[model samples]
Target: MSDAVQASGAPAPVGHYPHARRVGQLLFLSGIGPRDPASNAIVGNVHDADGHLISYDIDAQCRAVFANVRAVLQASGARWEDLVDVTVYLTDMARDFKAYNRVWAECFPDASRAPCRTTLGINALPTPIAIELKCVAEIKSPLPLAGEG
Candidate 1:
């Protein structure tokens, strides 16, 4: 049954797809954008890249994106505290970079102990949402090592 979902507390996948997957003691999560998992769409279109679409608000997107990430962690039995490393991708650095770090600090427990992170700007992404986060986490479990006899 555990192989089925022992880690889950009968939690559903964030979508038809999983927000995260656990192999051994590691969890790999997809980017959590600013959207309610139930809704599957960002509250509104985010026009982040060079004013491509219409909206260009960074704060709102950061909040929502982080929230989505939380949901994923919960579903996978991991948490921000469990995170070992994170990768963030964005489109515009000048306009949103400073604000992004500020939001991240507010969203997490402490920056000093925060997971190793990388932030970079790209020309394009799946949506206009200003920030996307992917995480890797470790959950301690008792299992025999391959070399164990």
Candidate 2:
């Protein structure tokens, strides 16, 4: 049976779903954004007087989103090196791609160790965040249930 993972250290999911799900050796993470866990605030977002998004810092968002992904991976008993694939979504590809790529290289410094990635330019997200990541990891060990050690 598959198990759902809810990371207490990560922001609560925007919808009813858990942060991730594990089926066999694979852990699939939901779309992870740059929302802070304690405040639920969008990182790097610059809003206008009426709270509309004016701009964002893609580098900060990328770091935060990667941190969120790491939290989900840890909660699922996986590791950063276990990530097999990642799908990135950006609201403004033309403006953010270079900064995003720079942060990505920092996170995955070694080309041989980096996960397979696909980045897409999207119109919007559930929130005003500029970027999000969907990730898949190969778990080397079985994840314990909520009650068991």
Candidate 3:
């Protein structure tokens, strides 16, 4: 196997870029958005920041991002608890930070023992998306089944 597998459960593969890649024990996931992996519909956030079809709910967005993260981990045969690091990018840091933290706390409690994280404020993001999250994880090798021998 290419020492890894590409995770593709999102609404759509926005571009040619692969959703995730695995090299030996390490798995790297791309930025995640709040949308239905199948329909590509933005989740939660009902009203757009400037009032448009493209919108995002803070909690929903967080969940969607994590959902995508979870999918990638599973595709690589990994798990959320296996995550070692994460990076987040936001359009408006001041406006969304508080809400983001609320959701973050729920998603990653005791992050100190979870994984290293860094959030940054950006000018904008992909169409209809406000926040994106990426992460790194270590996939554990699977042992033989209980009675495979």
Candidate 4:
């Protein structure tokens, strides 16, 4: 059986979806972006009065996206080291790939423990964020039942 997870520490999903869903020993995270949980603001995004895209800091977005992903993982009773795979989406690969990679290296310092990754350049996202992550993690231990100490 599968169970859905919602992270209180992460931004509310823009549409009808939970943060992650767990089936058996694997947890599958939805596309997580760099929006703040409390404010729902897209980190590193700047817009004009008309809501036109102006500029963004890819590094900041990358860091925030990782944090968001971690929140989902934590809520799902998983760990960073439990991540098995990640798919990254970037709005501007040419301008942001290097900066994103730098932040990625900071989060995952050890290659052996890092999960498999695939990064893609996309035209745009549902939000104004520059980066998003879709992750899959393995739950190392079975979670305790509710009310069980």
Candidate 5:
């Protein structure tokens, strides 16, 4: 049976789907954004009250995105070291990839231990956020028996 995973400390999903789903030894995370859990506000967006784009900071968004992913992983009994693969979507690759890369490097650190990633340039995202991350992670630790642990 598959288990839907939702972390209370992570940003609420914008859609009806759960933050992640676990089946067998793997956890599949849905599209995760750079929104703050407490405020439900998009991070790294610099827009006026009318929502006019002023400037954007991919770095800030990257941090929040990683944090959100981490929360989901933690809730699902996974960790960064258990990540197997990831696919990243960016609204503007030419303008934001550099900053996003820097933050990604900090998160993964050693290339040997990093998950395989695919970065794609997209036209738009759900909110004012410019980036979204989705991943699959392996559950390394033993899971509890249903209603037994």
Candidate 6:
């Protein structure tokens, strides 16, 4: 059976779905954006009081997205090292990929430790942010509080 994961410390999902789901040893995360958990605000974009888009910084968005993903993974009892695959969505690959890659490198550091990833250029996303990330991770057993035999 699969169990849904909703991280209380993360932003509430924009939709009805949980942030992640765990099935056996695998955990699947939903598309994670740069929304601040406390404010529900997009991290890298500036908007007017009327909610009109102004400008954005891709690097800042990338870092926030990664941080949000990390929070989801941890809530599911997984870590960055446990990630097996990741899918990245970008509204403007031509403009944002380089900076995003740099932040990604900082997170993984060792090339060998980095998870397999695919990045796609898209027309748009649910939010005004430039990037989002979703991933799958292998969950290690013997969880600290899962249960005791």
Per-residue alpha-carbon lDDT of candidate 2 for residues 4-116, written as tens digits (9 for 90 to 100): 99999899999999999999899999999999998999999899999888888888899999999988898889999999999999998999999999999998899899999
Angstrom error at residue 66, model 3? 0.8
Ranking by TM-score: 2, 4, 5, 6, 3, 1
Greater TM-score among 4 and 5 belongs to: 4
Give lDDT tens digits, candidate 3, residues 1-149.
33444567665557676777777778788777777887777787676577766545677777888888788777667888889988989887888888888888887788677788899999878766768888888878752344652
lDDT of 5 at 109: 87
Top lDDT hit: 2
Model 5 stretches with alpha carbons more than 4 Å out:
144-149
Taking the tens digit of each residue's C-alpha lDDT, what string does model 5 give over 28-108? 999999999999988877888997988878899999999999999988888889999999999999999999999999998
Per-residue lDDT of candidate 4, residues 1-149 (tens digit)? 79999999999999999999999999999999999899998888889999887998888888888999988888888988999999999988999999988888888999888899999999999878888899999999876687752
Q: 1 or 2, which is superior by lDDT?
A: 2
| Model 3 residue pairs with clashes | 10-37, 11-37, 11-38, 45-56, 45-57
Per-model TM-score, in order, reads 0.74, 0.95, 0.82, 0.94, 0.93, 0.93
The C-alpha RMSD of each candidate to the native structure, in angstroms, is 7.1, 1.2, 4.1, 1.4, 1.8, 2.1
TM-score of 6: 0.93
Runs with alpha carbons beyond 4 Å of true place in candidate 4: 147-149
RMSD of candidate 3 to the true fold?
Answer: 4.1
Off by over 4 Å in 3: 1-4, 45-51, 142-149
- Comparing 1 and 2 on TM-score, the stronger one: 2
Query: What's the TM for model 3?
Result: 0.82
lDDT of each: 0.68, 0.92, 0.76, 0.91, 0.91, 0.89
Q: Which regions of candidate 6 deviate over 4 angstroms?
A: 143-149
Clashing pairs in 6: none
Model 1 Cα lDDT, one tens digit per residue, 1-149: 12122223222344466556678788787666676555556655655579556765678778877776666666565666888898988878888899898988886767788889999888767655667778788766443344651
